[model samples]
Target: MINLQGVSLHRGERDLLDSADCRIFPGHKVGIIGANGCGKSTLFKLLLGQLETDAGRVDLPSTWRISHMAQEVEASEQSALDYVLDGDSELRLLQKQLAEAEASSNTDGHKLAELHERMASIDGYSGPARAAQLLDGLGFSHAEQQRPVRSFSGGWRIRLNLGRALMCPADLMLLDEPTNHLDLDATLWLEQWLQRFPGTLLIISHDRDFLDAVVDGIVSFEQQKLVLYSGNYSAFERARAERLAQQQIQFEKQQAERAHMEDFVRRFRAKASKAKQAQSRLKALDRMALIAPAHVDSPFHFTLPSSDKTSNPLIDLREADIGYTDRVVVKDVQLGIQPGRRIGLLGPNGAGKSSLIKTLAGTLAPLSGERQCGEHLAIGYFAQHQLEALDSNGSPLLHLQRLSPDASEQSLRDFLGGYGFIGDRVFEIVGGFSGGEKARLALALLAWQKPNLLLLDEPTNHLDLEMRHALTLALAEFPGAVILVSHDRHLLANTADEFILVADGRAEPYSGDLDDYKQWLLGFNRDKKRKEEKSSTVSGSEEKAPEDKKTQRRAAAALREQLKPLTNKLKNIERQMAAAEKALAAVQEKLADEALYSGGQQEEIARLNRQQSEQQELMEELEMDWLEISETLEDIRSE
Candidate 1:
């Protein structure tokens, strides 16, 4: 277990946490969540012993090993595989000792044997294979493993860093925004890996679905306090809402009681007969416990302006060929952005999601097609590079002023306040502001233009829960068409009306939800692996004698026969699980009914509860059986 007591941390003059306490037991996966500037990284640093708590004690077992993904890696000539293998410090130390023992003229035979035994015990010989698996899971190609670390781009290097961290064996692991540079496919793979991690894990991420899928609990930073909530991100939201609601109710009740006592004291203070009672009431009022008002204060509150008049189709792409010089990514594309249409773009990394956005934004020209814009069309485009385009010397007030030169200073300040730039902060130079602040400013400028069509790529990258919620609400209320490319599934689910998958140098509509997309990803990866295996076999067969055709056929037949029972069993389990889930859903629906908790319904409620519990248990058992059967089937297929 890890414990922190009375922890107070500060970055410069701003307090991130004050007298905060948190306890995490072994084997618990906790997601740390907060705004961009909120000390999430600082907390990780404190845990890693790189930074000391300002005023508190952080205690953990001295012998326990901790591992964390590095945020930056130095450019090196070392191969990616070797870099990952270096993460296993013990393995490296043993190898070094063995080398030294071999070099010495009087080296003991026993010492050499001992070092080799230790290496084998740690499975050091298999380190390269494990590193390769990690790299593949993170979207690295097989050929890329042998390339020098300095040869990859910045984002690819980040993936290598993650691979290195995952290669390390540790009692605790810390990951901060590991999916920031990952596509949906890699993100899903990482989630699965984290699910199977048998150690304490703390991850900081803005991606809600990733958090919900990977973490068993959430650690939230709010108002300079660290709060621990059970279950996933969705559960944390529900628990927080209930807690705030209860606080509000208590506050209202306290207010009513105080008002009543004050009124009695005011009305009868001058009457002789009621003077004693009035004085007593006044004393009671003075000594009464005061309840603070419930404040779910979200610092962010902004709305998109209504779009200007536009044609039926705000923009159209006809036979579009989009890409850079001498490179075509999406060819023969046809798309129409109609009024009030919300579309999301989904694809693997390097599949040209950003290229499509740039082409639509007119920053890139189509190579061989017509791109049409409505006469009244006005576009608002935002991408990662937009953050860099901001004037560093300017303030929030200055940026807003540039958009509305004729507007009053007070009006501009009022508008900026909605994006959390209140009072004097509006005048402060944005060059010194945090990433979240910079993103908010960029959004404020974008919303001020009132464009009829909006294009956003990864807009939620630096945003927190509150800002994200605010942005979701604003996008929902916006009366315009939107084209979004984001890894934030919650945003995609709530904001996008449909999805378009970009893959294989083409873009087309996908008739499925996010869940369906996940299934498709799994199948795609499996197919890729099979193809690679077949190719490898063909290349290796050149050096060996050809196998007998009859033997090959027999082996295939035997494998099929062996897989039949397992496949049938998997199907039966799926059917049973579906039925159990349906039954459970019906009982939960009944439980949600307010009438179920009324008087004279105790027996009915109890019976429903028993049914629900039984169905849930049945579903869990079926799921386990199904997983086992599926894994067995996969193993046979691989063979």
Candidate 2:
């Protein structure tokens, strides 16, 4: 077990943790959650022994190996695979020793055999394959894995760092926002991988669905204390909500009592009959410990204001080909945005989701096709690059003031406060702000524009959970149309009324939810891999002695015959799962109706709840069956 007893940590004058205590058991997956600067990463640093606590101690088994994802990778010419393999220091050392022994002039057979045995014991020979697998799972292509690490972009380098961390063999793993740089497919892949990880894992993530899917417990930073809660993020939220509700009740009761005492003292202090009673009441009020109000609300509370002018169809694209000057990424795109339309772009990385958003925003013109816009169309485009475009010297107030110079400073500050830039924070320079803070400022600037159409690309990249929830709420309540590209599944599910899949050199409407999209991605990747493998075999056969076509045809026919049943079974399971999901969604939609929960219909509500549970169980079973058959098919194909 890992234990922190009376741990107090400080950064400058800020008290990050005051007498915080948390105990984590072996093989337990826990999520560390808090606001941007609440010491989630700092706690990981303390565990790694890079920072000492000001008071108390943190204890973990000395024999337990630790692995953590690094925030940054140093610029190097090292191949991505080699860099990942280097994560296993002991394996590398053994290989180095084995090489030296084999190359020595004396040729020490005994030493060479011992080194080889040790290497085998550790399965060092399979390190490269495992490293490649990690890279592949993280969205790296076969050719990309061999490229120099420094040659990739910053986001790709971050993926390399994640791959390296996974390559290391350890008992405890610490991951901080691993999905921040990943897309929806890669995020789903990582979620599955982490679920299968046997080690004790502690991940700090703002993505609620990801955390709920992976972590068994939650350790939240609440008012300078680390409070460990049983179950996942949703459970923690419920528990915390109940606790806060009780606290609020107590606070209100105490406030009433205090008010009565104050009133009594003011009315009877001068009277001889009640002078003693008033004095006693005054003393009682003075000695009474106050119960603070529950601070359960999110700090962020803002909306994307809609334009006053009307736009029936905000933007229309017909036969549009969007991409750079060299090539088209998405072809024959036909999309129209109308008032209050919410569309989420779903596709793998580099599938032109951003390119489509850019084209709609007028930042990138369609390579070919007719683009039409409403006369009153106002676009508020937000992307990760917008965060960088922010003036470092300008404060939040200054940034907003630049948008509406005629507006009062008080009004602007009030607007900034909705984005969690309150009071002194509004005057703080953007350069000193953290990524989450900078993201908030960028969002604040966008929200102030009152755009009729909002184009947001991964807007939740650096935002915390509260901010994400706020953004979701804001988007939900916004009157204008929204086009969102985000890996945060919760946000996508809540904000997007429909999905547009940008893939296969085309942009088309996806007739499925996030779950169905995931299944589609799996099939898409499998088909793509099969095509690549077949192409490789064809190319290799041309350069070598030709195999007997009759034997090859027989072998291919047998493989197909073998895969036919499993493929049919997989499709059947998918269809059943889809039906179950649809039924569950219908049940959930009914449950969401206010009238269903309003005073009556208890039996009906219970019936719907049972139906939902049954459908969910059916879905889970179908998914497991699908996975089993898919794995079997993959094993056969590989063989």
Candidate 3:
């Protein structure tokens, strides 16, 4: 619930938000879309009250709570849990006082009662219990949670801040390109979380799909004014296009009318009776506060320079053993790609995805195995850690000019604009860029290079959903063999023709599509859950699971139904056993808590624990049986 009335803002010689009026409502998922240096971030400062407005006023409730994540964040040497717990300092302080009050059982009954009530009112103060829940939800394990925040990377720190942002309940949340540092799964989790978040949201992101899924309205920054539409990005685009067309026509008509009115006044000022009419028309004309109609332009549209369609194979990796120093990460790999095969390297973090890409780019020598590329096969590589790769001494434009000396001025601008680096952004030092900006710069250079083969490693790292799609389309159309390591599901699905999954020390021909990859990933996580639920050593054992699990039991049951005709009936029996064991686990957790343990409950707890141990073994046996049956079915079904 805020409003900007006649906001006028300027940056240097350019007018950014000129006499703009905008409204942000409660419970509205609003996304701000604009080109770089079009004053998107500048508008944010105005809303943040960091800058003074020369004209107009921003109206918001005095008691409204707000959070801002600065571009350059400094993280202290605090533990992950400690950092997130500090989000609501008031609540944490209240919790501390509540603990003190509880520990000291005083004779002052009235103060004790008040303390208990105040403690209950505080949020996220379950101490370890609440901290563990938040850490787990953010995909951090117990080990990661215990580790100090300094051990984490910059991206993870941003995530830590994001977790803090979500922990505090606010009326409106301002996110400036939140998706920049997050991976695909993290992005999906956040998308789902924000969709369910109960507040008015204002997000500035280049991700079209994320915006489409989340926002209820699109606020466009054009013609130095704020144009608001009542729907998501797609709706806004269609409406904006129509509105622009209408405005152009209206502008032309109004100009003609104004000219006619002026001409009549000029011609008839000397006439007696017509002089009054001319003066009246002149007064009306001067009062007309016409808007300078905005000429609509497409944001990102660029085509690669068509090079000779050479017959040379773009890249080849035969029996490649790619790794760092003595550690062999990926071995026994064979790949041959020519100019046109768009390949996507799919795998999790620390899967040697980057190493493989680097080895192919000839930046690193393989530990062992033959590798060769065809004649005239030029490679353009875009590294994920672009900040390190950039020439720290050079200006932003100078870096690109050094690589592509012959590139025209417009060529650079057009390419830079696609990645949201327009105008003076190109003049700033490369080091001044945010993580997202640096990533986008690498992308812009990749376009300028115009190489025959492209090796993009995690190119979607800081890209919004829209920019990712734009890249996908560009790569798909380019007459080049693209071997990219990306975690963005949509980009991989759209841009890549062949999928190479680099994991477990191999890169094999993955037959399944992106949908199939997603399905396989889901099954993998489900199986992981099942393993995590296992509590003891069996005849043959595997990974350890959590102490308590409900979803794991469900998947186990589904596996049993698939083996309905089995004579062993091991599947169905184990499925039921897992359910019983889970209920047993709940009782054990209750016993651990020591909360409201009524008399004569000891025997029941022991019985449940015994059943849990027994069920663990049964499930292991059934899992082995299911594995055998599954292999057998695959063999039979192939024929």
Runs of candidate 3 with Cα error greater than 4 angstroms are: 99-117, 121-139, 245-296, 299-301, 306-312, 319-322, 325-331, 364-368, 395-401, 404-441, 460-473, 487-490, 503-506, 511-639
Model 2, 1-639: lDDT tens digits are 999999999999899999999999998999999999999999999999999999989999999999999989988999999999998989999988878887889977888888889899999999998998888778888888889988998888889889988988989999999999998989988987887789999999999889867787899998999999766675466445435545656546545644644554454334423333223333332222111112235677677788999677889999998998889899988898999787889988789999999999898999999799999999999975788899999899888888889999999988888888887988998999999999988888888889989999999999998888778657755888989999998777656767888899988887776778888887777666667667757353346566799988998999999999999999998889888888978986785464653444656755765575467557756876887798799879987
Clash count per candidate: 0, 0, 4
Score candidate 1 by TM-score against the native. 0.83
Local distance difference test values of all predictions, in order: 0.79, 0.81, 0.65
Residue 115 displacement in candidate 2 (angstroms) = 1.8
User: What local lDDT score does residue 153 receive in model 3, on the 0 to 100 scale?
Assistant: 82
Assess candidate 3 and give its TM-score to the true structure: 0.68
Per-residue lDDT of 1-639 in model 1, one digit per residue for the tens?
999999999889999989999999998889999777889999999999999988999998898888899989999999998999888899888878988999999999998898899999999888788888898888877888899999998778988889888989989999988887787789888987887789999999888778877777789997899999766675565445435545666546545644643454454344323333223333332222111111245677678996657887888999999998989999988999999887889887678999999999999999989889988899999986677888999999999888889999999989889998899999999899877788889999998888889899988867777788778757855789999998787777656667889988999998777767776777677667667767776453345566799988998899989988888888888888888888888986785464554346656755765575467557656755775677668867876
Off by over 4 Å in 2: 249-295, 538-625, 634-639
Q: Poorest 10 consecutive residues of model 2 by lDDT?
A: 286-295
Q: To one decimal, what is the Cα RMSD in angstroms of model 2 from the true structure?
A: 12.8
For each of the candidates, the C-alpha root-mean-square deviation to the true structure, in angstroms, is 12.4, 12.8, 20.0
Clashes of 2: 0
Q: What is residue 9's positional error in candidate 1, in angstroms?
A: 2.9
